[model samples]
Target: MQVTQNIKAPEMLIDYYKAIEDSSARMLEAAKHHDWDEVVRCEGACAVLIEQLRYRSQDQELPPEQRKEKTRIMQRILRNDAQIRILAEPWLAQFDHPFEGKPQVLH
Candidate 1:
């Protein structure tokens, strides 16, 4: 008898991507409510997850069977990022406007 693995690829990648999607969704909700702080916090969390995913991916490649699922997840992430950027544009413009007339300060 031969032992076989059930996972097509390292499931950790899927889990990490899912976690990022969940955080992106949360950020979208917070942005909808104009909760900029919470959105920032969630964005921070997403960044950390992204770093971990990158590190993990450096050592593991997704199997052919799992590539399709990864592509779908990536699409969803892109859509979420787009929506979040749309929601944040006005808030970002507001911040920019306040500094438009100020002299640039060199640190």
Candidate 2:
């Protein structure tokens, strides 16, 4: 017999925040390894989670305890993002002017 596992969607706004925090952490890890593709993939996941969070937030509010947790999650996510940016600056600089000294017009 084969068994299937069901995954559940986050039911609270704070849950979405947690998911975004998780994605940011993954992105930071990928940046540490210089895995640009994985970083981009995790970033996409964060974007989707952020959009979902915005929609759900319109109808739901976090409890006091969850709000405190959400604040912590947001702080951690921000720190991860800052580190990722620091790691990416050099990598991103390479594309700043790929056509330097090349002809302005192709012919």
Candidate 3:
């Protein structure tokens, strides 16, 4: 008798990636509308998701097939991040311009 099978990959890892992607999408929407507060909120959420993903990755490895999927997801995430930064640079410069000559307060 011969058996052919592949071990199943853990679903939790995929879930974490999905959650991060969702957060990035939300951030993109917020950035489009110039809603920095919402973007920051989503950014915080993404940070937490990243920490969770890091912890999960220490113990779980994706299957070979899923590796491709993970790569695609990561690419989308990077694209979202790049666009967000592009949208934010001018707004950030506006903030910086006002404080350039102000006295610094040390706390």
TM-score of each: 0.77, 0.85, 0.80
**What would the per-residue lDDT of candidate 1 be over residues 1-107, giving only the tens digit for each residue?**
11121212225677777778778777877888888888888888888888888999999877788788888888988888899899999989978678787798989
Q: What lDDT is reached at residue 61 by model 3?
A: 84
Give the candidate number with the greatest TM-score. 2
TM-score of 2: 0.85
Single out the weakest 10-residue window by summed lDDT for candidate 3.
Answer: 1-10
What overall lDDT goes with each candidate model? 0.77, 0.83, 0.81
Per residue, candidate 2 scores C-alpha lDDT tens digits across 1-107 of: 11122223778888888788888888888899898888888888889889998999888888887878888899999999999999999999889987877878866
Estimate, for each residue in 1-107, the C-alpha lDDT of model 3 and write its tens digit: 11112223325788778778888888888888898888888888888888978988999887788788888999999999999999999988987778687898889
Name the candidate, 2 or 3, with the larger lDDT value.
2
Residue 22 lDDT (model 2): 81
The alpha-carbon deviation from the true structure for residue 22 of candidate 2, after best TM-score superposition, in angstroms, is: 0.6
Number of the candidate with higher lDDT, 1 or 3? 3
Q: How accurate is candidate 2 locally (lDDT)?
A: 0.83
Q: What clash pairs does model 1 have? A: none
Candidate 1: C-alpha RMSD after superposition: 10.4
Tell me the spans in candidate 2 whose CA falls farther than 4 Å from its real position: 1-8, 101-105
Off by over 4 Å in 3: 1-11, 100-107
